[model samples]
Target chain A: MRMIPAYPVRSVLVLLAPCLVLSLWLGMPSLVHPATPEEIGLKIATEASARDDGFGNFTATQAMVLRNKQGQESRRQLRVKVLEVTDDGDKSLMVFDEPRDVKGTALLTHAHKQEADDQWLYLPALKRVKRISSSNRSGSFMGSEFSYEDLSAPEVEKYTYRYLRDEPCGKLTCTVCERFPVDKKASGYSRQVVWQDKDELRTWKVEYYDRKDSHLKTLTIGNYTQHLDRYWRAGEMTMVNHLTGKSTVLNWAAYQFRTKLKERDFSKTGLKRAR
Target chain B: MRDGAARYALALTTIWLAASVLAVEAHAEIEFAAWELSGRVSLESRYFPRTGIDPSHQSSNTNGFVLEPKLYVEDVEGRSVTVLPFFRYDSADPVRTHWDLREAYVLLFGELGENEWEVRLGADRVFWGVTESQHLVDIVNQIDFLEHPNGKVKLGQPMVHVTWTADWGVLEFFGLPYHRPRIFPGQGGRLRFAGLLDNERVEYQSGAEEWHPDFAARYSHSFGPLDIGVSVFDGTSREATLVCVPPACNPREISDLSNVLIPYYAQIRQFGLDAQLTLGAWLFKLEAMHRSGERNALGLQQESNATELRGIGFEDILGLYREEEYVAAVVGGEYTFYSVFGSTADIGLLAEWNYDERGRQALPRRQPLTLDNDFFFGALLAFNDVESTEIKVAFLTDASRATRTLAAEFDRRLSDQWSLHVESSSILSMDPDDIQWVGRRDSFFEFHLEYNF
Candidate 1:
């Protein structure tokens, strides 16, 4: 119950209150300068996808360290090659390189935008290539916390987006958005919440909601480095499966962009020979 | 003699290990694309709590070891050569000690017509069926009897494979040149009959015997949710028909004879269709086959046992009265419930109903030496963690015999390269008269420690 100065102070405060309220309300939404929330989400997603175009192909080596609730750890190393397809989704091949039981194991993927992706697994022990059912994509990847759907590259057409909010996440201003998977039959998730920075349009964090609408996993990306001065690739990505009390950390190194990768390299014929 | 073979196998494994290590060291400075060596060595112990029916296996506890050394070499053009030599030594069963060249082949893969055609030429092992309990349609490789009773292991088959992939689907052809024979237990093995199977008595319907030519063709395609594969094979049957000495034979002659069962390989043709549909977490599968000239020379119907010979004693050679054609089918499904009982582990339940048209087992259990209609149910709880711990439980029941075979397995990864496994299996039959059949074998518990290198 502190009393205001009657004449000058009250009049000045009353005059500036509406202007301050209007500025606060209008300042946040107009930062990115989009028309609607959905528009903003689509625009951001499109920008992210567009910003990553014209890299041709890339090859990367990664180390995956898995840990359980008891702090027990296991490690695996693999090489990944991705080819950019203009009309359809990308074609990628992953070859395992460590832990003798699974050494020389490989997976080749031909992702499509509309239909289920075709995937083949070459088990070194069996010495044959096996085609896995795309609809049965909920199995763990190499017994890790990551599922097959989680390891796949997320395409722009794979999800429908809606903007949630704008907030400052750590140092960067991030736009929170919700996305629903387009292929409801194959994807194990019902929806996902993504946080991408406004400056680089790179994903900072994501929360996965499982088919049962339960919060299942959380993925955080960090230590990003710009490749070819345009494409942003995260150096470290950690995925924590909340329900399972297990986590997988992927540390990527030696990313070579614009590598000469052909369609033959991703075919099933080359799966067993991949290294 | 067993000790000598064991020592020789051990020395061979040691020599291969040393040579692989030396080769790796020699190529240390060069790029690793030239060659890579990887393999596994496991030591296993089996303990039978119950006294075995077979007096030959008097020792309840036994120890064994297996060394599988595999080498993969790649040329600059991506053509690869895989050499895997497997050796196992089991002290309890002298016949189980053996060595095999599991894989020694050069795989040449190529694509033509703008990726529309692909060919794979090599000696390899191929598994064709999708069922978890039994593989009803797999016939490419001979069953490795010592590996497991469930027929999950195989011996390599020399073959050429070619596939044509187009907008319609994939059409594949296989030409099998070398047909290998299945090995049965030699005298001292468990789960075998009172006497050993005399390989000398092996008769092939085709006069060519083991050198018969086999060929297979398959067409696979996907129509929406359903994936289908239709296959046809012309070859000697992998399933062997038993030729036994009549029970009326004199004890002196029986004592003189070493064979309680003689494998008769029949020349047959098989047409099969395998289909699977996946919708959400449910998987429905079916496998159907019709065999022409199946058991055309067999003696029994697989369900009846006669203490008295049908029309003759030991004077007449026992053979099928006429040519027979039969069909078999298996229909099953798997339903998975994720986060079952509010836990992170997933539980899957599978059911399979197998029907054999030639099998007639509606009456009481008088067991013969062939297969019959049955049902199987299996469950798997996978704890996908850093350890990848899992437990599998399954049971197969023959209603006519009122007997069941139950199995349970637990596997745990101790470390990145180390693992421990325990498995138990038992057979229980309702009919006391069915004591002398396949499922009547004594139960066993197997434990193993494996180290992957």
Candidate 2:
């Protein structure tokens, strides 16, 4: 207003010159060459495997809906409480909310590479918990369209992967990768191919093959929403059976991770009387 | 002499032709067979005071045992086949001749144009229901309640059947006319034919037994995270027509003759719906059924003295009567969880409600009334894998003054194929005023060693 910044403007410009130069110098390497599809795909896979939420313990509530091609639908409300989630691994319990009476029942899984994962389901009606075998993981979970194999957290070591190519996916370029199941006896699929966004490393689609090498199903994940600045998760996953013409869609809501929880909260004594 | 020789030569030629035909039929070979064997046993003990208030003056003891074995074999040659089978059983007490030949039969399978078909002349479990539980449906083996009451057990008989399968569905026709020791009269001694269709979204079956033609259909779909299904059936069973009617000349005497015997002339209808959903860490399931029927013989039992005094009129008295209608419904669900505190733990909860009503055309003056109302709840918790060691407890109540039962069970897997199981059930009458001590008692226990192959 009073010609106050004439002297200050030059001085500020002089001060910004070095900072601008430094930024340009620092960004020069990335700008010179974009990441190739293979490099980008590997980077995404590695990053997802290495991510740690730092909650040590946490809990989440979710509403799940399954829709079929015929437009029929079913819904359930679920709560998962995490007791110990370290950079190395995690342990958690889950329970159902609706139909009112079975609200407090829970399931626990302890996963380790050296041994078969230990799993158990707590039933309120029986007031007893039953151990489930790892071999039985492929069976239907409570008669839902999703099998137990679909619900369990997939450990990165469960499969081995190789980058395939760059593929145009919708309006964006995506890196495609092929994954083969490492444990042939334990897996339901012989191999799977996944497509991920080149820039963000978000997985967008996957195709699974049966043991006979026949294409079995295709799954598409969408509706990405950012959480906690660096976290992104899909809100919907649709799977279609190639041979049977049956399809299932999973709609998820209220996904959260990283809250302070403890091992004591997931104990047998705790399960018998969980609220 | 020349005439006799010519006749002998003709007979020899006929025998040779028949032998060749038999040989060709026997050599048309495609054979299939499978066998399944399962068994369970447990030990139990109980304590009850002579008086309701006296806890100290009580008595308790325990014992249990069981054994079961099953086998099946089939032979198919070209268009013809045969089957043989057997089952062995021992439970709680020892009995003579535990082994019984359960099935024996022959069949023919072939292809006509692009369609595949089969004709079977033997015995097999008739198809019915998405899930089998004798408590709810029929065609059961009468196994102990521990096993799935909803599973269909193979019961053998003499039958002739034809089946055709295509991309759209399957159609079948059958006739069974025989008898068995433990089966109801109409069930074992009747002719039956049925048709079935199975596709990705739906399944249906329809058939005629000696007394009725039955029809059933089920449709399923997925929505969001849940799977849902609906099923309906008509004319449930041939055995449902056992109610005797009084003779025209003698209203007081029960007549053995049936007034309505044509298939589907009288019918029973049932509808069911079920859903399963998973949200987060919880799994939810709901199952329900609504059934209504005409001329239901199973509900025509004679009223006991106590039931009669409970406002049941003289016209409602048992012998040889007809009911125009009846209705029943049940709903239930279960939830389960596994592992707490990093230890191998499992748990679950279940609840169900059942209601039944019977209309009164035979009850003289009283209108249709509620026959029974039942509510059931159960909870299960296990600490270790049953393969190593496990324990469980369950409670059930019938709110309509029938009976309440409390049970506990433990199982140990001694080895890869061997296991030890123990269980006990305690029954209590809600109305203490009408206690029948002998058959309806304090507790029952069982013990068993099971092996799998």
Best by TM-score: 1
lDDT of 2 by residue, A28-130 (tens): 4456676544444455577665553543555666565544456555555677776545543466687865323334468876664434555656764333444
Candidate 1, residues B250-333: lDDT per residue as tens digits? 222322234366666778898988887766567788988888865642334332243344554322344532446878778899
- In the predicted model 1, the residue pairs found to clash are none
Deviation in Å, model 1, residue B223 alpha carbon: 3.6
DockQ of each candidate, alpha-carbon based? 0.25, 0.02
Residue-level lDDT tens digits of model 2 in B28-56: 64444433232222222223222222113
Lowest-scoring 10 consecutive residues by lDDT in candidate 2 chain B?
A: B190-199
State how far residue B119 of model 2 sits from its true place (Å): 8.3
What is the Å distance of residue A271 in model 2 from its true position?
Answer: 34
| Residue-level error in angstroms, candidate 1, position A62 | 2.6
Per-residue error for A9 in candidate 1, Å, reads: 55
lDDT of 1 by residue, A1-275 (tens): 55756767879989988987876565546654645776667778887888888888999998999888888788988999999988888999999886656677898887888777776778777555656556556667766777777778788788888999989989889999998887775677899999999899889999999889999999999999989998999999999999868899989999999975667677655665574
